[model samples]
Target chain A: MEAALPESARGGVAKPSSEADARRRRAFIYGLIAFLLVASLPFLPVNNYIIAAVVRALIFISLGQAWNVVAGIGGLLSLGHGVFLGIGCYTTGILFNQYGIPPWLGVWVGAVLSLLVALVMGSMTLRMRGVFFALATVAASLAMVQISRHFVDLTGGADGLALKFFGNSWWAAQSRTPAPFLYASLAFVTLYYWITRWILNSKLGLEMQAVRDDEVAAAAAGVAVFRTKMLGLLVSAAMTALAAGLYMQFYMAIDPEAAFGLSQAIQLQLPALIGGLGTAWGPIIGGAVMIFLSEVTNWGGTKIGVSGVDILVYGLMLLVVVLYAPKGIVGSVLRNAMKGADR
Target chain B: MNAPAVALEVRNIARNFGGVVALRDVTFSVREGEVVGLIGPNGAGKSTLFEIVSGNIRPSGGRVAYFGRDCTTMASHLRRRAGMCRTFQKVRLFESMTVRQNISVAASQCLPKGRDLGEEVNNILAQMRLEHQAERRPSELTLADRKRVEIGRAIAGHCRLLMLDESLSGLTHDEAEHLIDEIMQLNRARGITVIVVEHVLSVLAAMVQRLVVLHNATVIADGTPSEVAHDPVVIEAYLGTKQKALR
Candidate 1:
């Protein structure tokens, strides 16, 4: 019966049995462990500074996971993702300040607006490849910054907008301490991570990856190359906007430079690149490593009375990561481990 | 009995690149279930014709029809969905994916809702005799195996007409013969129309019911294998000044 099969059809090499299942099970276990650790963070007698760092790390995880969808999976490296974040921040801020809208409701509005911007940006830039696409996105972000600056009456110009203190109202997303904000960040990051995982395992994800591999071949295989790339950008933009809305509520202020600066884009992308570009767990691990390193450097630099020493150290750390683990730490480590197991 | 329907029709097709004339006023058609061989020397516009028919490039002038429906302006993917599938001369496969995945991805495109994609892929793998290497990537396969994967991918779709471009170019004589037999079996069993562009005369003669020869961008001969072999123009084209030796 097998001999009658075409040479291409003959089952010769044995596939690793239950490998996907085993990996899923392992992921579930790790996720549960991480969730428990986060859930218990408030119960521990941690200092306020420690809690603040954890909240910042959670925010990066959200941003990195969102970036992974567009750059890592869709293969469109967007250097202007910060524009969506700024849009989210400004949308929530303006609505709350002028219309008396609650941040809870305003964030959703911000997300929808960000998605619209993403659609326009993706349509314009997705046609370009590699460096051209990246440059287009950077141009888009810079344009947003200028727009925000020019509309001084609406955006408070360079002075920025500060959220009014509403006496720890959950509806307003205003709280006195870092604990509630930490939990909120934790929830958002967890949701984004699961969403990333679900997408990675779906048929759509397979199509996205097929397009990433070869657009011409993918089109021949009936995958809509442009549509898939746009979908990735939309999803990524929405998630990044959500993170930005949360960041505004937590920090209680936003300025064009703080929200739409080039550094904001770098901050979102660095975690994903340092951890792993495409993997679900990459952003979380990378975000934690980045936040911890930054904190350590900041503390050491202040003790030594050097104002710019922390940024120099941060740059050095990134250079080392790029040199040694070009695939990102998590990706390289997992690859080597898989190879060892195969051996 | 009714005559078999024309599966593909190429009418007055012409293509040009600036000053270079790749094809001019070329026309041919393949009937349903017929195996037609397209043969020409290097730079004969064989590949360009395939590209035009497959919707990869728009013909400068002409119309392509499938089953009497004009599809000259249809997109390549839409053409594939309309039951026209083709393989490339340079065996292109998704190198990152396994052989099974490469076939499955293409096959899944034409499948109607509720069809089992895995089953379709497995059938193609078995038909192409690629089951043994199903888990291997295209990079891991030999040139012959990679070519098989490409052919397998084309056939896995709802292929009413399969256009093969130099599919037997890089294979050993034995390997070529084996592939030719498989192609014959596919045509016989599935009643699929085939248009093969090949440089191997022996393989071309053995497989095709009719031959269409192109030289200097125009059809020089079109007939059965024996008729084409005996055609004076074809002899002159192939032999050049060596036509005296044949005489």
Candidate 2:
């Protein structure tokens, strides 16, 4: 059946199989295992404290993977992704608090609003590359924070709005108990991971990488660099917003600083940088490592006389990893393994 | 004669970056099935011309017509979809990807629907003699092999007019000769219009039917290699001016 086509269409008539096909298959199996692992996290007999930490890590992981669409593969760093997360968190929080709308319904509203915001961001900033785009995004995030703080009647300003859960509604009060929120976070993170995987494998993702590698070359070869970057930014914003919705249920609050802060932005990049820059599973692996480190830090700090050690440790680790590995843990390990095998 | 039977025509293309002129009044045309050589001194705006033709740069003044259709403002991908494909001066293969994957990616962009991509990739790899290196990364390959894969990618993409920018820049004598043979084969057997930009005169002399020489953003000479090589104006304006210094 394949023989009837032209030389270029018969898979070029030379190899048994291509690397991409093999990578896709392997990724699928890895994705399945990851899904199962996340699906089982809530069932573990961990303390509520551990569960809370895990849920928080998962939310940021989702956002980080989403951000990777633009920054990692597309190579357009956006410092304003926190704005989308804040937008989603606030929209859902406002809807739930004012109109008695459930968190589930609010999640939809937040996602739509974030998507619109993303569109505007794409139109304005995605055209710029590297530092210019990053600056634009940072400006946007700052602008959003200013609005959130100034509009006290609606957003509760710097004090932020808090949701009072009565533990009665099924979906609305999922965060009244630790188990429900943990499970929800798990689902959200897993969904984002798979969604990113799908996007990266699709035509859109390939074009994004092309844009990243060489916009001039890609363009000459028939790639729309601007359009690809726009799509990547939109997807990145949407994912960050979705994570915000998941996070809103747990915190039941939205403060400009807490939700729209630069610190939160660091959380997104931490896992992504620690795991790998452009690799698919980098964010997931980084998220897990971050959680383990945080837990250990928490335990160790309480046992000893020291505190505020987690952030310090993270800073040090980031420096060491970026300086020594440069490709993150997954990248460094893979390179070493390949070299070892070759030897 | 009939619109010069041009497969691609670049008309009065000019580009400026902040006050610096990269290309100015750059106009040229390639006919179907003809192997045209674009030669230039260093920084003579050869790449700038190709970029304008391939829609990488929007010409500040003029138009790029493919099959007599104005594509001056088309997006790069759109232009690519419209049958314009080019290789880079630096050999831009998808480095992390395998040779087969690299070819398949380029092929899939233009391949017919309902075809197995794997087989299509294999066929292109066979032509480049890279089937054995199908699973290996471009990083693992030699410079000559990488350049060959780059050509394979352009060929697989179903480009009617392939513009190769400095494909033989760093290659050895034997390697350049072999690539020239492959390019000739592509042009002769498949009727693919090829525009080769090369520094090596011997390889280009053997491959190209006609040569266009650019000096200071203008086509100083355009004709058969022998004619251009021997023209008094070419000798006075281009060759003689820099001949002593170059040697």
Write candidate 1's Cα lDDT for B144-211 as tens digits.
Answer: 89988988888776778988999998899889988998888889988889999988776788789999
Residue A192 C-alpha lDDT in model 1: 89
- Chain B TM-score against the true chain B, candidate 1: 0.95
Q: Residue-wise lDDT of candidate 2 within A213-325, one digit each (tens)?
A: 76765665466678878778777877777778778877878899777688777777888888777666778788888878977987899899888888887887789888988
Going through the candidates in order, their DockQ values are 0.33, 0.37
The model with the greatest lDDT is 1
